[model samples]
Target: MSRRRRAEKRQTAPDPVYQSCLLAKFVNKIMYDGKKSVAQRIVYDALEKFAKRVKAEDPLAAFEQALENAKPALEVKSRRIGGATYQVPIEIPANRRISMAMGWIIQHSRAKAGRAMDERLAAELSDCFNNQGTTIKKKDDTHRMAEANKAFAHYKW
Candidate 1:
């Protein structure tokens, strides 16, 4: 809530191999301590494994579908009106939806034990593509919360 002008949206450059902006963004999200090369290697490896796991001829398409499946359409936001706090349902914007999906996928993948990051990510992606995984479960939870809070949506400013 800065008083300054809104920041302009910066366009991400497409990834070198897939020429996909979404994939590039996903790689950037996976990067830690600015080690983009390591992140890219891991993500690319996961994509390959995911393609083989799902028997997908187009890994990018499969990955996109998995990401889409993990994206939540609605979320609940807390709004304070007349000294009362309420949970207001809100539609998520496009960029937030994509980032949330990527974050959830990465976080859920990282939580598993006894697996490399790439292998875990590949398994999670395939599970998500099939509409059954932690990410998708999180998405469903978000939608459910939003639905339950629909009565408070009028409190949105």
Candidate 2:
């Protein structure tokens, strides 16, 4: 962490094809070793696959809905007070919620075997859109943990 100053958030330009900043952010997160073009291709292909499966609707809409479905409302944070550790429930900020959803979707997609990256991502996205994927399950688990630990929320400060 930087002590002197908060880091400035670099502005991200919307993707060329979809013209969406959120999608651009997802693509950036998907990028590795600075291979943004490869990431873009993968994501675009995945969206196309998702569109074909769903039929009669925009894939971008499905992507956004999937992310929204995976966003967690609350999460637990560990805090120490008086030699005791507690799990404090905290509300998730909007930006964090989106980023977490995106990360989980990518992570779970990567975990699947025997498929190309685009196909895996498309499958995961479709699952998420229908609220039946690993990412949604993870979000539900986080909410459950937070609900269970609500008594410790006062220690959050």
Candidate 3:
């Protein structure tokens, strides 16, 4: 880690269609090998599919809700103090919470077999919106672990 002053966060432009920086960040996370256009197409197609599934509901709103549902309130961090390492329960930072939710969503979607990327993403988003999906499970697990390790929370810096 650098000892210098923390660097300022770079600003990200919102997605053209949705006008949402959050959605743009999600698209950037989905991009691989610098293929941003391909990533954008996949995300847009998935959002369209999701919109079709829920009549009269905006896909962007659904996506935001899904991300909120999947966000972990607490997480355990390994901290070394003196001679022993302890799992310290800590509240997640806001930006990190969003990033982690998006990561889990994409990760679980990629784990599905025999499906196109767009379809898999759509399914994952829908499931997340309903609060019943792999991402939600992962979030629950994190909270559980943090709860179990609450005794060590004082070890947090």
Candidate 4:
């Protein structure tokens, strides 16, 4: 952690369709090479496709569901003391937990077998919303690992 005083929090505007700042942040995180337009188009396209699959609600609900399923409640961190390394399991922060979930979902989506970015994103989003996907699996794996290392929870700060 930095020794300096904590910086002021900056506000982010919500996306036009969902009116959610979290969605805006996720779009920004998904952007590659600083191409906001491409990221926006891809996310919007995926949302449109996802919205069609589930009736009565907007795509943002699907996005939120995916995020909820993908977030990891706990994670392990490496720490060194007296020339020994320890894998300490700890609860994740709220903001960072969400960011990690979104990043992993986007990354795994890109790694999937799909013809287009939008298609991959849509598929991943659908799976996550349904509680089954690479991202959700990853979160489960993390939880399992944390559970296995429950004895090390005392090492957390």
lDDT of each: 0.95, 0.93, 0.93, 0.87
lDDT by residue (35-152, candidate 4, tens digit) is 9889999999988887776552778877888788899999998888678888899889998899898999899989987379998898888888888878889999999988998887
lDDT of 3 by residue, 85-146 (tens): 99999999999999999999999999999999999999999888889989999999999999
Clashing pairs in 2: none
In model 1, residue pairs whose N, Cα or C atoms come closer than 3 Å (at least 3 residues apart or on different chains), thus clashing, are: none
Error at 37, model 1, angstroms: 1.1
Between candidates 2 and 4, the lDDT winner = 2
- Clashing residue pairs in candidate 4, if any? none
- Local distance difference test, candidate 4: 0.87
Candidate 4: where are CA atoms >4 Å away? 1-3
Candidate 4, run of 10 with poorest lDDT: 50-59
- Model 4 compared with the native: what TM-score? 0.91
Task: Residues 37-121, candidate 1: write the lDDT tens digits.
Answer: 9999999999999999999999999999999899999999888888888999999999899999999999999999898999999
Please identify which of the two predictions, 1 or 4, would achieve the higher lDDT against the true structure. Answer: 1
Return the TM-score for each candidate structure.
0.95, 0.95, 0.95, 0.91
Per-residue lDDT of candidate 2, residues 72-125 (tens digit): 999999998989899999999999999999999999999999999999999999
- Taking every candidate in turn, the Cα RMSD to the unseen true structure, in Å, is 1.8, 2.1, 1.9, 2.0
Give the poorly placed runs of model 1, Cα more than 4 Å off. Answer: 1-4
In model 4, the number of clashes is 0
